[model samples]
Target: MLNSCKLQSRNGSKPIVKQASFLTHANILLRCHRQAASRLGRCACIRAKLEQAEVATQKTKDEVVVERVSSTGGSRKAFAKAFTAILGLKLAKPEDLDPETLLNPPFPRYQVPGSDLAVQKLRPYFFNRTYTDTDVGYLAFFAAMHLVAVIGGPLTFSWEALEVCLAGYVLTGMLGISVSYHRQLSHKSFRCVKPLEYFLAYCGALAFEGDPVEWSKMHRWHHMHSDTTADRHSPRDGVWHSHMGWLFDESLNSTRRDANGNMKDSLSPPWFYKESPEFYSWLRATYMYHQIGQAAFFFALGGVPYLVWGFVIRVLLTMHMTWLVNSAVHIWGEQRYVSNDNSRNNWIVGLLVFGDGGFGVKLRIICQCRQHIPRHHNNHHAFEYSAAHGLEWWEIDMSYYFIRGLELLGLAWDVRRPSPSQLVAKRIPPSPSAGASR
Candidate 1:
């Protein structure tokens, strides 16, 4: 089922394809025809063949007229906005997409669950939210930090302390986001030792992005819905909307939380957080225990500095940089190889994000951008939920490295890699410095 988390307007560009009526024609099996025809229809797994088609326009016979107008002109700006908004909701050329073709994309191998399922409809909005004290507390925390950056400075305490905290933040970005959240929590890319897995998730919870299950669901949805109305965060969509828009929206988060937050039955084995009730229980207790621990530390320290830096400032920094992975990576970056939409292998953000949040692990040894999931991210928008993002020898994947280490120790298994043929097919030009690591 394609969950509609809803959308709203801001001052940025509108999504390229809006009405997305074509979305309605997908998974004919899941349409009103099926749902209305039967009270309870069962959809079981079965192999179905689909066709693949691509249109190449080399000569560029058709030309889209370009109108140059004053940047500050209201009508010119309004015209641009109106045109994109209309196209967003209108039907796209079937030639632009073959929804059926999505059943299989360029990954050649290793697809995530639900990647091949057809989406039949789209809702224009999400729901309402009931926030808690914790929500309010964090909201204020973020507001304060934003004010400080605007008024004071970065609130620099000490380089030594900042660097340590920065390294820890980098860990949260790399180990926490890549290992815990993206690969492990989101895609189940590999397995991990129990104690380490639980401990890592506990830290990720501190990052407070949201519950891991909810994050995974939306992310899985993002892969399935990339570059379309379905994508929760695509640069092709409105910039801010694709950036921090949905994450901060009460309705969207609330709807996602309701679906995924309390789901223990949703787990797939060896996927402990979803599979093992014990793991879930342990993490819940750990979450509560962490709060108590923070309070206790504040008691022991008896100072505002710890509360501000260790708690508030720390959380704020982690939250946005994690968001930067989704936003910054899409907007600014050097594309080692283009797949589709707008996903670049950002160098500064990679180092800033501590080696593509570990996605560039083994592949990082090659190019540091390929490897791991979201492979051929350009391709990902063109092909969602591809487990192997790197189709070339140079793309480094940091998360894969950790997973590989665990596999060597007999603590992890089922590490998924793109087939050798896929690598040979893309055949990205070789980088002279492929096996370098940061």
Candidate 2:
């Protein structure tokens, strides 16, 4: 929102400091003269000039404040002052100012309290679409991929191609997206050596969800501001908005841009950026090209069948599953524990997402495959870094099994967990079958 004001200035022969001083004395004189002069005479002579001088002083003060701010690399506090001073009038002290003026103004903009950026944190206007050219390009790509997947997936159906599709799904969807992107990168749920870690992250990049760094930062932001206006994929924005609307919405991108532009004054610690290795950062920066190369390789190897199944179908399926966690899981299923956001556990979504299959007849046989993620997903929201999303005998998380298998092989280590006692302390309700199983 912008505020426009017009103020007339005098072509003064004196320095601003001297003019300000003269005006200050003139205001005092005007006040004294008002008592003696008739009301009509008093109004005619000095009222207009008095108001103009006051505007000039306020403008000069505003300029000095903004100069101080710009010299120091800028800050939210500095910008807030500049925003008010330049665009609108500041209210006087509580004793003198009208309460209404303080309550609201013709145009209002503010910096989010405690945010470090100098950019005004204007409230989100959901209807005011802010899509950029990049977002439109992504939409175009999505449409093209879907069209190919629909037409080619049927025409090129074969046992060999189906096998390829299922293998790629398990590798890219389960290990790449679920384990690498959601668990390791998003939550730091476990630690692995850099070589293995980056390799898995590369697999995630092949999933075409976005780059590793972008995924990690967005997830962190989601957790930090879940369900609020700042949350990138809050279900509160409606099912479509939470599921995929946020991907194209400029709200998330704008926040990230502001963060980068104001890093010097950012309140977020340096460790957030330093957590990822240089190689991973480089991959993330150029990940679009990497994905294009993957598509080209698939095309060269097996033609349209390979391209459709490997790139198009794989990406489409992975996107839906990932979106389910943000949308269906929040809207359906029971909330097991008190949480800050409306995250839930939908068994149907979990079964489809975390299950694995290598060879299935026409690939539809694996559609009903089960995974234990939904049984313990609430624990993920409660204990973010815990490797145990399902920390019980009946709660069977296939992803956890894979992580454990890797730990036993010494390929992955430092598997973080919250003890059963901690779960009880968090007031997590025990399952009805808990005692019977024990």
Candidate 3:
């Protein structure tokens, strides 16, 4: 009964283990080098600003030496080049579209040369798409589920069923989506026991976004290509696409389209849940039976009421709340950290996704309401391993609290957080802080 949405997981660094694999160690070193390069880039930016200021006081021509990031691994270069061509852009690789170009304009915005057109040049928003069988299946499933949840749920609602729904929401949303999918799988923010990890992953699978592996791969891809033309769900792709349209295009390998809707390059590809033979083997083994078993358990507990509220209603709400992270958070919220992508720390979303849980008691008192729990999602995009999202104590993250609790209980360990220096490096300087804040 498991849908055919394929899944894949790249071999990631194990931040917890003392004697990690050589590849893991190498990845860590690479991350450190990248961070160092970013710091150096920031310094270069400051020097440029200072030179600009000095030009007013005394005219001098001393060019600052800005470092250009080296191209990625060699053998991969040919592969990347081909991939880039398929995506339709002339870029050699993905790194070519990095945020550093925001200052230097590595890939400059296209300019129409004196074309008497009202809109001179088009923004690089990818719109060319095709609705595949997968798309139709997803839409049909989603629509059917929503219909049942809407009409059947209210008709069968009872206080007992409401209690079950509330519990199911917390289980599927918090444990499944937030903790398992987001923190553990997607970001690798914390490491937990394998059994617990698998259990949480199973809970997440019930959310039906996809198997945990696929969900994590998609999310990781989002981070890697955030806000770029390659980013599958960036609002820049069009708000609707970011929210749901992108779901149909599970084949991440498709090339992007030109402004005229011509396909440029072919993206890479997707994986079936079995692609990850290790981490997600159990999920694949029991994908269908496990889900059916849960539904049966709910039905046995409270018949039609429990089945309607626990399964249908919970799935519908979870789907929307998850979608809002892609659409609403990006559009409505404010950015705390100066990340490259347009990711924001939506307080409203933070509250809904991860409840206040007594952590933001002061914010609650001041705001005169229960909401306003700070989830530094921007920081998540900035420092993937950071368990702590909020910069200060006031900005509470219940998700982090749970992770910390698990760590204390010995259920999890080696919770990764960004160092003070790492934070300072990414910090927006007061001079250009206002611009970065936007």
Name the Cα RMSD for model 1.
Answer: 26.3
Off by over 4 Å in 3: 1-130, 249-253, 256-279, 355-375, 429-438
Residue-level lDDT tens digits of model 3 in 1-438: 123222212222234254466678899999999999999999999999998888744522211111011122322223334444554654212222233432243233332232211111112223443333434445556677888888998799899888888888888888899888887777777888878887888889887665665567677667767776656666655566667766555343244433454321221212322234465654544555556677888889889889889888877788888888886666655555677877776677767777311123446667664433455667667777676666556777777888899999999997998888888888655447545643
- Residue range 1-438, candidate 1, lDDT tens digits: 123323433212244344354465565647767776554333221111111111112212111111111122222223334444554533222122333433333322322232322222211222333333323333444567677544433454545445545655656656777567776777776667778877667666656565454456556655544455445565443345455654434333323212334321222222444366565544443453454466457436634444445555555677766666676666654444435445555544444444442123344455564443323334333223333344344445555566678888998777666565654564455465653521
Q: What is the lDDT of residue 138 in candidate 3?
A: 56
Q: What are the runs in model 2 whose C-alpha is more than 4 Å off?
A: 1-130, 251-276, 355-374, 428-438
Report the poorest 10 consecutive residues by lDDT, candidate 1: 61-70
Please state the error at residue 382 of candidate 2 in Å. Answer: 0.8
Quick one: ranking by lDDT, best first?
Answer: 3, 2, 1
On a 0 to 100 scale, what is the lDDT of residue 212 in model 1? 57
The lDDT values for all models are 0.48, 0.62, 0.62
